[model samples]
Target: MDKVIFSFLGTTLDAGYSAGRWERWRPTIALCQQEDMIVNRLVLFHGGGHDSLLKLVIEDIHRISPETVVEPVRLQIRDPWNFVDVYSALHDFVRRYPFNTEDFEYLVHITTGTHVAQICLFLLIEARYFPAKIVQTSPPRNSKRVDKSEVAIIDLDLSQYNQLASRFDEERKEDVSFLKFGIATQNSRFNATIAEIEQVALRSSTPILLTGPTGTGKSFLARRIYELKRAKHQFHGEFIDVNCATLRGDGAMSALFGHVKGSFTGALQARGGYLKAAEDGLLFLDEIGELGLDEQAMLLKAIEEKRFFPVGSDKEVSSQFQLIAGTHRDLSQDVKDGRFREDLFARINTWLYSLPGLKDRREDIEPNLDFELERIADQLGKKVRFNSDAKKSYLQYAMAGTTEWAGNFRDLSGSLLRMATLANSGRIDEDNVSVEIQRLKARHQTINSDLGVDESGNSHQDWLELRDRIDPFDQVQLAYVIKVCKQSANLSDAGRNLFQQSRKDKKMSNDADRLRKYLSKFELSFSQVKEW
Candidate 1:
């Protein structure tokens, strides 16, 4: 069966009764001739006063085609200029209308309504309150005769447009690249994470928590998200980024919630603060874990109420700002430790993302290296290039088992900066590569010197890395054995000292044998730790 065509009747002089009678110069009548397919029903919405004109319209529609049923819906709307009344009436009509898409298709006539009514109809259909296609009616250009001959059906769904879809895809890609600062990253996990962040940023204004080690770009990512939202017309105010760790004592409160003049000794002038500055925009609080308990309480209120009072002020100011928090500390652990507010953590924990450290995403190192080189060229106003040998040598040492990127991307960035600065004549050769490698090794070795490890330098320096290589029980016991060996003179002496307390329980008391076997569990010996 064909679907019903729903439309609003505009009671203008042309559509109204003229000369004390009906006129065949109606748009609905002319609408019938332009149709290629049969219309099951024509539902017209009109005011109670337009009953006579509606009867004429129905008669004309029937005269054109007896197959089409005309249904006139009586609504009590006195003023079409009152958008609320007209929209509410139409909304109620649509809600009460029996919509069965399986049995009948639907079409909404965008024409033949007041301008306000037309806008309401468009909004309702776009919101899916009316699941129907749009049909527009046009009268004859001469204005003397009615003509629905110029009619058009517009499809709202844009997926049908191939070129438009391609354009949208390209826009999304550019947004992702902007977030990465045009790094052209290669890590699959990292790429997927960026895409997810973009979607959340575009659609929501909830508090987002970015947790990662220092120098993982949490602050940078938050700023990019703000820019993306601003570009999409989601926000308009300035992006207020605060390093919460730097806020101290009364300064924290004064900086975040503002302060009235003369609130404190140094209060020279009244300030609007970060929240007000970020009104209808984004508030990025980096190192959120460092915020004091009082600050956290005030921040929670600002987020929940969108209103807060500044220091020494009774008047409440409003700021409906979006929040993004960055942290290196485990907030849940802080909550348990009584250092962070539990409620604040719970509120902002809805959208949490843990950015991976550089060591964890070694696959992206090559591309990042190239990105840094370009960044250096941009910064110095002169391009620099690494000789083939230098590039290959740096990559080898960077990816070696000995390398521990404890500081993650920040460390890599600094290393590149140093190498670029020391490059002779804008070119990094083998000499430059050799110097950087030695410096990195010296730094890493100095940091790890205190950790008990192989004196022969044959094993990985970090004992934490061996946690996966052995059983939990063996790992603990092996660490203790290594510690004892470091303090003792020789293997027998270290073994004897370790078993001094528990040796009485043994049947055959061969202390060295027992210690040897225990050490062997971790593939270690007294010589390794003692020599170190």
Candidate 2:
């Protein structure tokens, strides 16, 4: 295979007005003269008015190596120092030049060009505008002869460097851990999801939607994503956080897209809102589903086009920012119910990541317990540790299915804070954990006693009084049966659903009587349950 090198013609270095030019080694001539690194063809690029120098260098290269081919090409660049002109000329030449990797190996000679020319060539080579390795030549230690020149070839492909590749892998893992709040989370699925979220947050500026129940770390993860991107220099502006639930009517509009003076009855002063403040940064609208339809429409316009008219202002304002939305409510359901704008929902739903609640992630509780203690130490300036027995006892109760973890991470953090605050000196003993467990059990029972509504976050006030009197275990079943009764037309309809599978074995399925007997256990009648 023929070995080819592309290089710029250094007019002064390759020129010889007299015999004295032979004293200094010329890079182009030396590249061809190196016995260890043979060059079959040289494509020498030079600007106009360098024909004499170009000819002299080519002749010198051929004098020492008779078999070497000298291919002199004129770039016609008025200024070799002008990057734009030099790059454009070289780019066109590269496009037109025949590249056959199977028949030839190529190298970009960086030793002889002007600084600007060298930079252009490096940029083009790194971007793979042409396929080649970079070859650099330097002056020999004690020689000025072309035959003694030093040559170094560097391959740009990173996969070839094992140590550097391993370093990058380690950095990527550290970034993933950052997004997870440095938690040693054990769930495989959750870890994989965090990895995906990390990648998406870094590589894209699109709107990211994080969905989960309350206290599942939607807001925390959103802020972490912002922090990660900011640390990587992806964002330059501030982190704008807004809870949509706090926004209402004119106030919501004013808070999001600025408001001019006299915008409303209480428009005391002009305001620059979150969207503008988040320019070149990230805006986390926690509980984004709580946004009113009008605000949603304006937000859609602002997010889609980066321009919007603020409240009571005819002039349009512009801002460019990244949007990350967090919602505990099901946005798809909000769109169906006409509570949220469908267009806005679709726009922000491009990268949706759902976080699992604490109850669903039992394995992570232990690690989070340690993390909470670490946080407590940081906040209170007092270090605390759980004894082995206390830690084991707490983990057992926390991992059990009976533990609701209603507020998820917040609830866990609060529980740990209480235990740590009450710990004897710096040690949490077994007795402390038992008291905490009983307190958590009582808290969960209180939460269950009011579990009268279905999954849609509705409330049934009538069932609350009856629910308060029921045992924690019985509250769930009674609440579900009451839900069916409320949805049913009458006693028989409710009875059939309540005894669905059991009625199949009856010779004469008196479902009403069976349901009546069941309702008596709760001291409730169908008519009363239904009416409520």
Candidate 3:
């Protein structure tokens, strides 16, 4: 019996089948089923689609490989198009299903479109999913042939695909670099802070706790640490990020540690949890403060002992992952309130760093704004420039207002993106600045109230009122003296200004002495008083 393997690529399951692309797939499917041939098992992979397509692909594989075993893998790729998920799914599939080329003679990949095919090719080279020869099935540009069998097979070696994948990865990596530290981009403060955090990441095996206001770049910093650590050493492990808030009660334990088959009502098969996925790499717990007290206790044990038993499993699994925890809440306060474990807090706090808010670093605003604008322009595929007046006005507006930036870097990036979209000729004017500032004030009014300021303007008003309240007498006296001197200078037509208004105008020399005494009380020289 012959053996054949097929990988189907498409935007969605139905589209690949309905567009007559399934015809090309049929040839590979038929080849795998043929007895006395060089084919036996048929492997099919689907990408990015509704579940209906996945079911259809599985059914098709079963129909083609009745005598031979059929293995089907469907990757659930998240939108906003993150390739990490695809790589992870493919790698997992390869690990579980190791193929023997001696039994299988042909391995074919049927591609739906350019991008889907390109990513799969990249994953193959980087992940080394299979040792079989790789080929791409490209449709004829001007032909009306809609059958999968009509698809052209382009033979490609590992090196050629590897180079292309490397270039693709490099381009993406470069783009992500802007999201990294000290790059002239939106959220540069967060990026730079994250870069600094990464430096200390590898120094100690202790768990790290990143505390900051929401959207202050906690997750970003954690990811950077993982990337840095991965670069420092060749660790074949995954960086698994989990939101502790989402994992309530049993779900928390199930997600952290693996669950045995029939462990719970929905445990159809034994599943490895995030701890197993992370292995030798970093496991980031985002919003760690939101974890319930019971869940916290479980997590603390895992951190301290580097082991956790799966839910409903008697066996203890070793999880030697580098724990990177982050939270927007004050964990110490949570501990005092008996909401968080003190021991857990102490363990994670061994390496702690607080990120400064956007308001604290006003100097970075202009540069960050420029970098964000450039990014927005590049993404929109349009050229944008800030007019001199608009630029000055916007900067002045940014400087004058005390925006706490409750959302921090994320909020700033969003505001800049909106401004760029609405700006005329890429020029954000004073009017635009004013409108955006008002919007920001309205958006954060509750936060402002909590901080004891109704708005930035109100803060400025309060400052003026406080100054008046503190030195009411001094202000009144200074104004009165300055007014009198001006009047005297005008009346006498003297070359020099008057020192002060005499208490007794008719007393002449007596009044002069009194005024001199008054000047001395205020630590003013007679000559200086005259100048004043």
Ranking by lDDT: 2, 1, 3
Give the per-residue lDDT digits (tens) of candidate 2, residues 255-319.
Answer: 99999998899889999999999999999999998888888899999999999998999999999
Candidate 3 Cα lDDT to native: 0.64
Candidate 1 residue lDDT tens string, 408-448: 88889888888998898999899998999999988887766
Pairs with backbone N, CA or C atoms under 3 Å apart (clashes), candidate 2: none
Best prediction by lDDT:
2
The C-alpha stretches of model 3 lying farther than 4 A from their native spots are 1-180, 184-198, 374-385, 424-431, 446-532
Which has the better TM-score: candidate 2, or candidate 3? 2
The whole-model lDDT of each prediction reads 0.83, 0.86, 0.64
Q: Judging by lDDT, tell me the better candidate of 1 and 3.
A: 1
Off by over 4 Å in 2: 11-19, 45-98, 112-120, 312-316, 336-343, 453-532
Residue 417's lDDT in candidate 2:
90
Q: Against the true structure, what is each candidate's TM-score?
A: 0.81, 0.79, 0.49
Q: Candidate 2 local accuracy as lDDT?
A: 0.86
- Candidate 3 per-residue lDDT over residues 125-197, each given as its tens digit: 4444665555444443564443322333444463578878898677545534633554544445655655555
Q: Clashes per prediction?
A: 0, 0, 10
The window of 10 residues in a row where model 2 has the poorest summed lDDT is 451-460
